[model samples]
Target chain A: MPAIQVTNLHKNFQTKRKAVGLRGSLRSLVRAEYGTVEAVRGLSFAMDPGELLGFIGPNGAGKSTTIKILTGILFPSSGQATVLGFVPWKQRRQLAYQIGTVFGQRPQLWYHLPAIDTFSLFGKIFELDDRETSKRIAFLAEAFDIADLLETPVRKLSLGQRMRCEVAASLLHKPRLLLLDEPSIGLDVVAKQRIRDAIREMASLEGVGVLLTSHDAGDLEALCKRVIIINHGQIVYQDKVSALKRTFLTSKLVEVRYARQVAPDFHIAGTETLKVAKERYGVKLRFEARQTPVEAVMARLSEVGSVVDITISDPPLEEVIAAIYEQAERSEAAIAK
Target chain B: MNEYHPTRTPAWILLIMRELKFLLAVWKTNIASAMEYRAAFIAQMLGMILNNAVYFIFWVIFFDRFRDVRGWELSDMFLVFGVAASAFGLAAFLFGNAFYLSEIIARGRLDYYLSLPRPILLHTVASRSISSGLGDFTYGILSYLASGYCTWDGFGRFLCGVVLACMAFTSFMIIVHSLTFWLGNAAGFAGLALNAMVTFALYPVTLFEGFSKLILFTIVPAALMGALPAEFVRAFSWGALGKLFLGALLLLGLAVLVFHRGLRRYESGSAIQVEV
Candidate 1:
């Protein structure tokens, strides 16, 4: 059975209108006005056991709202959701024991106390036996390589160290599923890499399903087996991470500077000249990696001039997602037309 | 998805015990955290004691000049402060977050408690500590002693009053704080209401009568938190003790009901990622 199943979920919020001045405030005290906002519009998705799925979206795209509903923190306006075959909102307390959550921006640790203290307290909260709690903490500390930092107060730990502790603490209960919202946010590259590795290992070793939300493309490419992108409260794209790259990651960006002036008519087959700076004697090219090999492209560039410098890189995940969003908009406009 | 299957829910007794155990563990962490800064901890406790002492001195002078107010002696005032302060102190020290519920709800800090497995309301209240409350509790003990009502029976009554008073005060604040879930940001208003409760509770019950007295014993319940407890300590009466106990229970039940109802409208704030 799938670890999580959400069907046509909808969430609407009513926010009060802010009064402008003293008169308006006094008037509002008598009778206030409100406006309804649709945070999640008919969203539907499911996740299988041991699957690493990336739930990505831009700001205000309902990513957090959807997670909140699935975690039983917020009720859906209309629809059905079950985590581990139990209705999330109805069986919140029961479901909480089976699922672990790590909000990168929110630390669950007691700031003035060591991470071990919070871990011990969590044992009581989850009703774990002392022996089991200690064993699990030790295992998690070793798994996340945080044993040395366990005694350090949360306020004294570095951001990366703290994040490691946060994720480790969440896993102390041996939950069957993990819901991570921006778990690698605000961490350095090395820290990000370590977290991704730990999560990947946990999913593989324990068969724990993970639903990770992140804006970092590297996180998706490195950890997630599947990717789901949302925009304006609806799913824009959903598929294997590899399949997404094979389909949308069509072009490779190349920037080059020449030793001398280049011709205005500079062009190559299966390649597009994005820009030609005459004053700087430089040119930028974009081409399908399949159509034009990197070696062949560089060989061609060298023929044109004594290449002073060259750089090649695949299009970033943001740009790829943006292109997908553009395609979606165009299709939507066409349907409207 | 599979059909709804009924798993054996734990017995209510066991669940309550687990919740209590979790609360005690949280309190341990809070106390340890508070003690991390030894000097600051000492200062906050001592500072509250000194502050409460000033109020006692003011009452001493007032009673010295006028002798008594409406058949109420200075000893009665001490009893009032003793009961109120001890109750306030015990509630604040143990369930400190109750006093800050409005701010927590307004700022969306409930996310932490909501995500945990424990009972959300109790967990949120027990997870914090008010260091200065220790001083208030000490002052309460001293005041009760100074009233010269230090007999064994009197001490037992004082302890009972403390429990009832704390329950009334905590539940009252919870009711006021729950307003933030519906009113968006009611922190300032909640603080004002709490200040008003404390201000009126410190005065003699003889000063109020008719509708004012009824309102105090019912809606605002300053009498329930203070006058009733003080009256029980001063002159033990079964009727008054029953009312104080019953009032505390009713207010607590009402507060819990109101808070859960308001949770339906809670719109989480976005600025709750930082440490509390």
Candidate 2:
């Protein structure tokens, strides 16, 4: 059975529509108005055990809402979701024991206490035996290289150190599933690498299924094999991370630095003319399995001039996500038309 | 799968104990940190002691101006003040985080408790330990001793009164904290309501006539924490004691029910990214 299965999940929030200005506020108090905002709408997905899945979307796209339902934090207005054979909302306590969550914005550690104390408290909370607790703490502390910072107060630690401890605190229970919402946010490059490595190791070695959501595409590239894209409270796409890049993104930018100036009107079949400069020029060419391979782009650039240096790159993940959004808008418009 | 699953994990009991343990751990750390600023700790403790002593002095002066205005002696008033002050102080120390509920909930800090395998209310209440309660506990003991109401039977009654007062006050704090689920910005309102309740509680129920006393004793239950308990201590009346116990039970039940019902409305904020 899959570790998580969500079907037709929906959530709506009743928000007070307060008008601006003192007069408007007073009028509202006398006769208030409220409107229902649909936060999550008919979302559905499933994740196999031991799979690391990336959940991505713009702000208010219901990414967090779906995660909350899966983690047993919020009940869906309609539909059903089960994590590890337990209905997440109805069997929240059981689900909690089987899942660990790390929210980037909030550290679960008590600020005034040392990281070690929070770990110990979690140990007690999860009902871990003394030996198991010590073993897990030692392993995580060493893996995250936070053993030295364990005795220091959480407030005194750097953001990176605190995040490391936060991740460790969540994992002390050795849950089979780990839910991370932007765990790499606000971390420097080295810290992000460390966290990515730890996540990969957890999924591969311990067989822990991980469902991660991040605005950083690098996080998805580093740790996830499967990606699910959400937008406007709906799931637009779900597939292998590689397949997402292969399908939505069709072209790659080829930059060639020539020994001399290349003709400005340089053109090649199966490739669009992009830009040309004195020493370097770029071309956007469709990535085809046969004709327009990397070698073909390279050979064509060489034909233009002596290729002193060359590099090929796909468009940024953000651009791809934006294109997906634009495509969704176009499709909706077509449906309306 | 193993077939040896118990009805429940006995987790609720363990969760409560863990909360108590966390409270103690936090209390120790805060005290150590507080002691680092010894002058401030001593000054604050002294200031609080004097502040509480002034209330006792005010009541003594009131009695001096008019002896027994409402069929109550000066000692009876002191008993009421002492019980309410001690109970309020105890609640403040134990559930001080209740004051931060608005910020915690708004910032989605409550997500940690919700994700944990325990009752959110118990975890929230036990998240912190307040040391200022020691001062209130001392003041209560001193008031009970110095008021010359320390007969063997009176001593027993006062202890019982303290227990019931603690129960009622804790229930009151729970109700106030649970308001965050609905009000979202309940800290200031809770503080105002709590201050008014505490102030009104430190007076004789007889000082107010009919409806007002009934309101205090029932709806707010401030009078039960103070006047009724004090009345029982001064004179052993079965009826007053029964009323105090009954009020404590009702308040506790109502507080728990309100908290659970409100929890269903709790749309936990996302901690993935806070706006500010």
Give me the runs in candidate 2 sitting further than 4 Å from their true place. A261-293, B1-43, B151-159, B235-238, B271-276
Q: Candidate 2's C-alpha lDDT?
A: 0.77
Q: Candidate 2 chain B: minimum summed lDDT over ten consecutive residues — where? A: B267-276
True contacts kept of 2: 0.39
Cα-based TM-score, every candidate? 0.93, 0.89
Report the lDDT tens digits of candidate 2 across residue range B1-276.
Answer: 778855865888976776676556545544554454567667666677787888678778988998886688787777777777677666656565555666676566667777888667666765654556657766876787776777899888988887888788778767876788897667787777677678788766777888987789776778877888888887899998999999989888988898778767778776553211
Write model 1 residue lDDT over A27-50, tens digit each, in one string: 878988889888898988999988
Q: Which ten residues in a row have the lowest lDDT in candidate 1 chain A?
A: A15-24
The candidate scoring highest on TM-score is 1
State each candidate's chain A TM-score. 0.89, 0.90
Output the number of the lDDT-best candidate.
1
